[model samples]
Target chain A: MKLTINRNYLNDAIQQVSKAVSSRPAMPILGGIKIDVTHQVIVLTASDTDISIQSFIPIEQDQMIVATIHEPGNIILPAKVFVEMIKKLPADQVSIEVEDHFRTTIRSGSTEIQMVGFDPEEFPLLPAIDQNEIIQIPGDLLKTMIRQTIFSASTSEQTPVLTGVLWNLKDNVLKFVSTDRHRLASRTAAITAPDQYQFNHIVIAAKTLSELSRLIPDQNTMIDIVVAENQVLFKVDNILFYTRILDGTYPDTSKIIPQTYETEMVIDTKSLLEAIDRAYLMSREEKTNIVRFMTIDEHTVEISSSSTELGKVTEQQKVQSYKGEPLKIAFNSKYMIDVLKVVDSEQIFIGFSGTMRPIIIKPLDHDYNTYIILPYRTVN
Target chain B: MKLTINRNYLNDAIQQVSKAVSSRPAMPILGGIKIDVTHQVIVLTASDTDISIQSFIPIEQDQMIVATIHEPGNIILPAKVFVEMIKKLPADQVSIEVEDHFRTTIRSGSTEIQMVGFDPEEFPLLPAIDQNEIIQIPGDLLKTMIRQTIFSASTSEQTPVLTGVLWNLKDNVLKFVSTDRHRLASRTAAITAPDQYQFNHIVIAAKTLSELSRLIPDQNTMIDIVVAENQVLFKVDNILFYTRILDGTYPDTSKIIPQTYETEMVIDTKSLLEAIDRAYLMSREEKTNIVRFMTIDEHTVEISSSSTELGKVTEQQKVQSYKGEPLKIAFNSKYMIDVLKVVDSEQIFIGFSGTMRPIIIKPLDHDYNTYIILPYRTVN
Candidate 1:
């Protein structure tokens, strides 16, 4: 393989695929990034069995030549070294050539580096997915959905399926839900896809979704998602991200969401978050992270936490509106802080069934996002 | 103690003393910050046996009231919790009051925190330093000198004195030197002090100097340093920093620096640094960080590194001036990078006696700083 490419363009493409490079590869070849040079484009691929990422650089972009291909061939280079070297190359343009026996020479400005490359044939191939049924969603919307729900997914491998976010599609409306049996987050969005196409019980690992989120451009572009029997492919711009579908059935979480509340209140999101944050400093030292919330009056609420060794922290803030009986409840301040951070509304609506039941939190202006937290039982 | 102090001023004072708080305190009380509130100022102190720091917040500074003291007393609060809480307090002025039984209440805006405090008498007191003789130096100059030489200090405890930087005062000139056997860095500067106050063999731990560096103000101000029998006291503005001197004799490193050179070259500091940084990516993977430098003709030099598992990297750059015989030498790229990072010169002069002798690096424009690196004997 022989080609000259813009250093910045090559570096950007390498960074995109580097997320899939495993730190501890199951096979030595899995630690390599496969480089393929064709007549029209150069493709970089990295995979770790569970997740695979491929990025392409075309010969020309925006009337500027990004890469010049002298010959078409393929070689695999160690990802860890290649990524760092490309980033610090001393010139705007770099030339790479694969000589006999897979010895590759990379030259830029007055610097030249020779790297030993492995035969590309030894690298694992990406699973091919049938794209007959493609679901298209806005990149920013999908990124938001992932950010809002992915954090609630369980990180432990004991229940492998809970480590992924469940995706359900019905009537062109896609919904995402994730829970660790302690707290749950769900987001719903409308997507453009074939009316006849629908998927259920499809779960993608939180780790995979996070990588996809980073690859998604900030601009409002369309992303095509294709799901195979056991694989999912996300076509984002010139990048293709593929991941294996998590096996096992995800537990039904629909029944756990509270439908009604005995006590409801509207509070400023930032104010409540700040109050809980101060209380968290004390609770965190105790390792329980339990912060108590009590309604002081129709328009005021108090947040407090205490450590047996480090005294207590109490703060009161005014609520926007309250329309129920006064109540007291305690919860893990860390979880509440997480939910509040992602809430994009100025005011949030909080509903409580009782002290022991699950508490529901939602943006006052929107019904698409819902977060439920189980309150801690405290003997007061 | 009862006082209302500006949150920012209190926060800045706390941050200065927080550096001395040990993560793993030998005694439980050592993890607390002693707070002494007097009529004129509020003193915050933290000590961990080896080092102690005290910062004072006066009642008024720069025509602005920093603190209003209603009652004078003393108390000690947990450093970890108090530092974090003070940083995020919700008001500009926070009121702190000791109620009874060492229960302290800190009130800011609508938030109130009660913290359990330890007896101030139990906290370790700072060592007294004699001030009959004092050395005064510009804060910025001291900061720069520490930055240039501190990186060469040995971190291993086997030779405790090597972990400290040697300070020699003679004829109103103060010199700092540090070495870890393979590499040495020294910087010299003139200070205002009594001619009769010359002192030698005074070594301060690199760790303590690093913390002192952070507390130094960026503005040029005279800092008074008093050397005690085993403790050194630095009065930096309103902050007092005390550090224990490392025991043991420091080895003489003066002979290792080349007095004469067989080959001398002047090159742009930034250009050479960039080339070696790229080579580091390759050498670092081998864990040896070996990079070779050879004079090419009279005006050009080549920098390269090779690994048995990986291939080689070669780069050549032009030198401003070259004199004496041509030579080739190999050294650790990581150490060279550290020396180059602190060089505040556009061009650097490199002197090499031979392939095996130690190489000397200095700013081409000044004689205040010097760095010596031992070359590696490679089989090639």
Candidate 2:
């Protein structure tokens, strides 16, 4: 485009949209980023078949000047090559000039690079989502919700809807649930929305959620979420992340959760994670990742695992609190470790409703996080 | 062996000798590290076919006691497993006890790991090198010299000697030279050895030199270079690095380096490196990394490269000084950039002999570094 911009802002914008640009696109034009330049703002858009992203840059930001527009123009350059050139350019301000035949000249101080630009009309524009309703939420909380529940989604392709995280909103409480038949993870947060605003069982792909999380700011910035008939859009500051919603309805998992538990134990999260990691070595020898934990005495829980070729590993740690009947259970150490890693708390409470039921896990200090994992049957 | 040692010291020693341990050994016993414990010192040794390294831990160092041996014995432990266990041990002092049938028990705090150990007799002992001659040099200097020429060594195994850097010592001067037939890099340094102690044309494998460089201390620690008939040993403090010398004799590259030049240009080494890097893009486009440099005026040189498919790149900068007839030459920018990256001087001198001969590159403020690169033929 016929404009001058700061190198840092432009670099960041290009990288954000590049997440949607595939190296080998079904259409050749999909490999490029559509650059739309105007006197007020410049928009960069890139899309794959499933997800699309658009980033905007204003002339002045935060009371400082970032770029100056000499002439308003638009052109699409090769994304990969343009990114590499912008990264190594040795100037504070970068200028792009498109001449006849769509020939583009990029100048930054003493370094000038000329590239053959493609026709802007061939590039796909941003998809128009029917944004009739929208809900605003904190960026940091949304990111945390995605991180906590997305990992529990199934990676298998047979059930396409299971590969997404389900979003359920009612009475201003937003809850996210993800399950792969064996285990499930759920997180909830309170949002300041209208009393009548409600969205039920909206499934978003795990991959798209992760990409949007990365684009969201780490701090407490406000993000606008717009749910359309077939697509969802997440607007964070000057960036808009859009993804297609899964067609099928998310299955109901509420009946599987238990209201009462046969046994519950509170233990230090750090020590439990470490003990499980140590037992992981033994699980490899056994051919199945089955690590068992049993309550012994009044204050300790014994964690042990065994392998036929390699030896067995056993260790006992003092549990903070234990109630109900003394019980023994076995589960995949990797799944337990992964769930424990995402829960940020000094102590965790694990609930068990007999040996056949799914075990419930929750941070003692945080009510917003909850995880449930099924146990593997072992003949001891 | 039965011993209690500082965890940090033991971990460092294990890592030092593990560099010589091969993932797939010719013999099963060769995969283990030989451990010999005595009241005074503990030794860790590992060897592959091409290189062997031994590290020793003394009873006391810098007025601090490192380890104490309760009983003196010898046993070999699996290198990879032992290293991993040592890294994750949760104790300040680690105790190792070997029992009958070569069963080893390692204890650190409450964590204990049992690993299967090989018999000491099965592990091959270190090869004895005849220490009749020795040369002492600074570890940092040796490391720098190795880095400057090792990159020029041929990666192809067709010519075994070309895969090594030649060491020539005479007239109280030591020079390192390496070439892949297309280009050659040579570095010379003055040593304080006896005049009669002369060694000429000792070629050591580039892979061995690189491994030894990583073990060398970053400071000015003096390293003892002991040359044997077929093996060369580098001794630094408690570590002994031994490597086999290449079998073939290195070819004489001295006659190919031109003595005089028709054109010499003194320019800022940093600026010239940056200019060549920018022109590097053009060479990639042309399918043959051919970038041309020509004197434009009394104090400026124009660097340009073009790709048939992509466009062209051109840049001009003022030279500090020029002493030669106006001429143009083309060469591979990658080779020029590699040589310039290793040179430490602020200003460098580039000399050209006509247009078809090799170009001599040396630092302006120093006389120790010299690199000669052959020019490529380009059609005008």
Candidate number achieving the greatest lDDT relative to the actual structure: 1
> How many clashes in each candidate?
0, 0
Question: Model 1, DockQ value?
Answer: 0.81
After TM-score superposition, the amount by which residue B95's alpha carbon in candidate 1 deviates from its true location, in angstroms, is 1.2
TM-scores of the candidates are 0.98, 0.93
Question: Ten-residue segment with the worst summed lDDT in candidate 2 chain B?
Answer: B80-89
Over B58-77, each residue of candidate 1 has an lDDT whose tens digit, in order, gives: 89989999899999999999
Per residue, candidate 2 scores C-alpha lDDT tens digits across B253-364 of: 8798788888889988888888788788767756678889888997998887877656666778678988878879999898999999999999999999978999899999
lDDT of 1 at A347: 95
TM-score of model number 2: 0.93
Q: What C-alpha lDDT do the candidate models reach, one value each?
A: 0.93, 0.85
Best by TM-score: 1
